[model samples]
Target: MVRSEWTKVWTTPGTAWLLITMVVATAGVSVLAAAVTGCPDTGCTVDVAKVNLTGVQLGQAVVAILAVLVVGGEYSSGMIRTTFAAVPRRLTVLAAKALIVTGVVVVTAAIAVAAALIISARLLPLSLGNGTVLRAAGGSVLYLGLIGLLALGVATAVRDPAAAVGAVLGLLYVFPIFGLATTDPDFQRHLQQIGPMAAGLAVQATTGLDTLPISPWRGLAVLAAWAAAALLAGGLLVRLRDA
Candidate 1:
């Protein structure tokens, strides 16, 4: 069942487009950032990792669409009934879908993030030898994968591709915007500490540790928590509802 579903996903036009968008957007933004920015000699240079991965913020919308379409597409076409009939076990079906989607997203994100980092290293003045760069590069990939999973979970719960995609993107970006809009530095800092985009991107921060609103790893962890919670909620909905 898993293999069959995997094959279907790869063969699907939407999946192909999603994957291509993810790769292209990531690489394109990284290249642009590298071209536009220069590294500083004293303070932490323009975080090459962050620059290369800036596209992830935009790429995540594509990931969300893909993830939502994986399940929601079937629902929209009334094919989920057939899927449930064949799989029978609701939990198993959801789990299989999650695993397959996560696997693909993780692999693709890893490749995209790594390529962006390597390109940035060559194009930028910063030294790739720094441990912070390596961590940021790896973390960016993981973050993209997690965003995919979160979108998948939300889609499962919403059961509507358009709504799911909107919700996921809203969740990822809205909070960050809210953070920025606030005049209170403390509130903005608080939002940055907990907002998914604001917090998750913290992993890319290579300098100004003391002045940062939140620690890099902790911020990423917060985003992970949001993903886990969404998945848990979606799983509950999947288990309780009828197709």
Candidate 2:
């Protein structure tokens, strides 16, 4: 069943393109970010990992689209019926899809994140491969993988490509907006601590941990919590709803 799901994903058109886009878009944008933000002097204070890895802000949207199309596209075309016919266990089907999507996104995001880290690290004079730098680099890859899982859950729940894509992007962005709009400092800090984007990106901070709303690994755990909740909800819905 898992292999069958994997084959279905690879056989689909635009799958390869989206994966390539995630890698290329991440690497290319990160290169530009590093170039423009490159330390021209010894006193610059940019968060080196965060600076180059900012491309993830763009790459994740592509990841969302890729994930949406994986299962949601099947529903839009009525192919899910065929899928259900082949695999009677709906949760297993979703689990397979989740694994395949995570695998692909992780591989592509790893390549993109590694290239971005190397290129961005070069732009700064700071020594690389510290624990913080390694965490930022490695966490960015895991972050993308989590984004893929979240998207899969949203798409499975929504079951419409357009709606699922929109919902995923909205989920990714909306809380950040809320976090920024309020005037109360305490509330604002709490908002950022919980917002998926704000908190998850904390792992990319290499220099300003003292000022961040949440700790790096803790923030990532927040995003992981969100992903787990999404997958659980999606899994239950897939089993309860008729294909």
Instruction: Report RMSD (Å) for each prediction in the order shown.
Output: 2.0, 1.4
Give the TM-scores of the predictions, in the order they appear. 0.93, 0.95
lDDT of 1 by residue, 1-243 (tens): 889679768876678878988988887788787777755434345555677667777777778888888888888989889988988888788888888988999888887777777776676655567898778877888888788888888899999989999899889888878887889988988888888888888888887777888888998898889888888888899888988
The worst-scoring run of ten residues by lDDT in candidate 2 lies at: 120-129
Model 2: residues with Cα > 4 Å off, grouped in runs: none
Task: Compose the digit string of candidate 2's lDDT tens values, residues 70-182.
Answer: 99989999999999998898988899999999999999999888877777667654456688888888899999999999999988988999999999899889987886788
Error of 2 at 234 (Å): 1.0
Pick the lDDT winner: 2
lDDT, candidate 2, at 124 = 50
